[model samples]
Target: MAQLRQWATTLGFSQIGVADVDLSSAEPGLMAWLARGFHGEMRYMASHGLKRARPAELVPGTVRVITARMDYLPASVAAEGWQAVEWARLQRPDAAAVSMYARGRDYHKVLRARLQKLADQLAALIGPLGYRVFTDSAPVLEVELASRSGVGWRGKHTLLLSREAGSTFFLGEIYVDVPLPLTEPVTAHCGACRSCMDMCPTQAIVGERQVDARRCISYLTIEHDGPIPAELRPLMGNRIYGCDDCQLACPWNKFAQRARVPDFDVRPALNDPTLLQLWRWDEATFLRLTEGSPIRRIGHARWQRNIAVAMGNALAAWRDRVLTADEASLRAQMVQALQAWLAAPTVTGEAQAQVAEHVHWALAQQHAPQ
Candidate 1:
């Protein structure tokens, strides 16, 4: 077990644990969450059904699962009181706020490749091992697996929380037919803390350790397609991508660790970018800038739509504030950006029309709050 830890550390994984394939205890909760229709538009989650809880069923003959954790905070964010820095960025109405995790290379790619390498090394040692690697790519109960294997306890926000790394990390799993030694589970440390629920801008965290994906900002921005709900737009503030308010609010995050790998380093283009800067991007520019990035998955149209929503929120947030000469000029520039996108689009077909609708909504925020 200790030897496996060393190998994982060298591969940018922070920790590893062995878990039994049986997850019958989690099936009820999974079914309940699905029954309530809390999964929103992610039909895949429902389609998989209990296959997520039964690792052995997903991969035939699997008897044990290996869970791995990889910290992903950019090296630059290791400064003291980093949560304050993120809060300051979110407060700036005209500044585009992207989730820190998405500021670099796609996590799915980074974790998946490293996990495969780890699996390959294991196979070479064991001689023809049958195993499958996963990193948020399929129907699997990742948090349940990690929690059972002592990686971390599930927090009130339903994300894996670590005493050493907080929740600023990615998780991956390997299912194998071997019956490896099982690791003990950790006790929950959340106690009476409700910081994550209090910090949610949309009140998405409905109960202790229960989140409605329909209201989750991360799901709404990254997963859902078509029009964003009008009522939720104003509450989104300047967050143009996935949100981090819950993780930022958790007290344990003061201990968050920086990624040992450079793949999570923040891109120069995403660092404190303003709404106008991103709003002016043509489809080609968007693709070029987001190459090998998770943001590219949303395509240029959704990117523009998200920014338009933020731009509208910015206008509403500025309506009551006294403006300086530069502030007034900034406001005018934002208006021009919205109007220009409305008039001439760089996207085509349904994408262009959807973005156009968002632009019209953005242009209509004069007396409104958002």
Candidate 2:
């Protein structure tokens, strides 16, 4: 076990633990969450069914699961005042606030390659081991396995949290047929804190350790591939990619670790971009700029759609208060860009409909009473 830990550390995993394959205890909560339809448009979650809870079934003969955590705070964010920096970005009504995790190379590719290497290392040591590696894969209950393997306790926000690393990390797993000793689980530390729930821009955290994805800004902007609910667009603020309000509000994040692997470093293209700047990217430019980044997975249309909603929110904020000379200049520039795009004939069909509708909503906010 100690040697395996050493190998994982060398592979850039912050921590690794072995968990017994028995996840029957978690099936009830999984079923209940699905029954309540909290997963929203993430049909993949429901499509997997109970197979998510049955690790051994998913990988026949697997008696143990290896859980790994990789810290993802970019090197650019100062460790001492990172939360303040993120909060300030959120306060900027025109900034396109991306979740810290997706600001760099796609973690799915990074973690999977490293995990497969780790599995190969194990097989070399033990001689002919059956194993499968998974990173953010839909058929696995990653959080449940991670928590049970002592990676961290589950926070009220349903994210795995650690005293040493907090919730700003990515999770991956390896199911092995070998019977490794199980690591003990950690105890919960969220005694009486509800800051995450209170600070969620759309109140997506419906209950303790429960999140309703339908109202989650992350889900609405990223996963739901149709029109964003008209009522929820304003609450989304300027978060153009994924939302991090819950993690930002958690006190444990003071301990969040920076990435050991440079692949998780924040890209210059994503760091503190303005809504107007990102909104101007055409489909080809969007694809070119976000080439290796996870943001590319959402594609150009969803990218524009998210920016349009954010621009609308920024427009509303500008209209709601008195502005300085600089603020007024920015507001005017944003309005002009939005209007020019509205008049352009290049965009059409569903993509055009979503962007145009959001643009009109933003324009309407200019004339509405504060």
Report every candidate's CA lDDT: 0.91, 0.89
Q: What's the residue-level lDDT of 5 in candidate 2?
A: 91
Tens-digit lDDT track of model 1 for 1-370: 7777888999999999999988999999999999999999999999999999999889999999999999999998856798999999998888999999999999999999999999888887777889999999999999999999999999999999999889999999999988879999999899999999999999999999889988888888899897989999888988989999999999999999999899999999998899999988888899999998999999888999999999988888777778888778878898988887767787899988988888888877746544
For model 2 the local lDDT of residue 331 reads 88
How much lDDT does candidate 1 score? 0.91
Residue 330 C-alpha lDDT in model 1: 79
TM-score list, all predictions: 0.98, 0.98
Residues 230-305, model 2: lDDT tens digits:
8898899899888998999999999999999999888888877888888888888899989889889888888888
Instruction: Give the Å error, residue 292, model 1.
Output: 0.9
Candidate 2 CA-lDDT value: 0.89
TM-score of model number 2: 0.98
Residue 272 lDDT in model 1?
82
User: Which stretches in model 2 have alpha-carbon errors above 4 Å?
Assistant: none
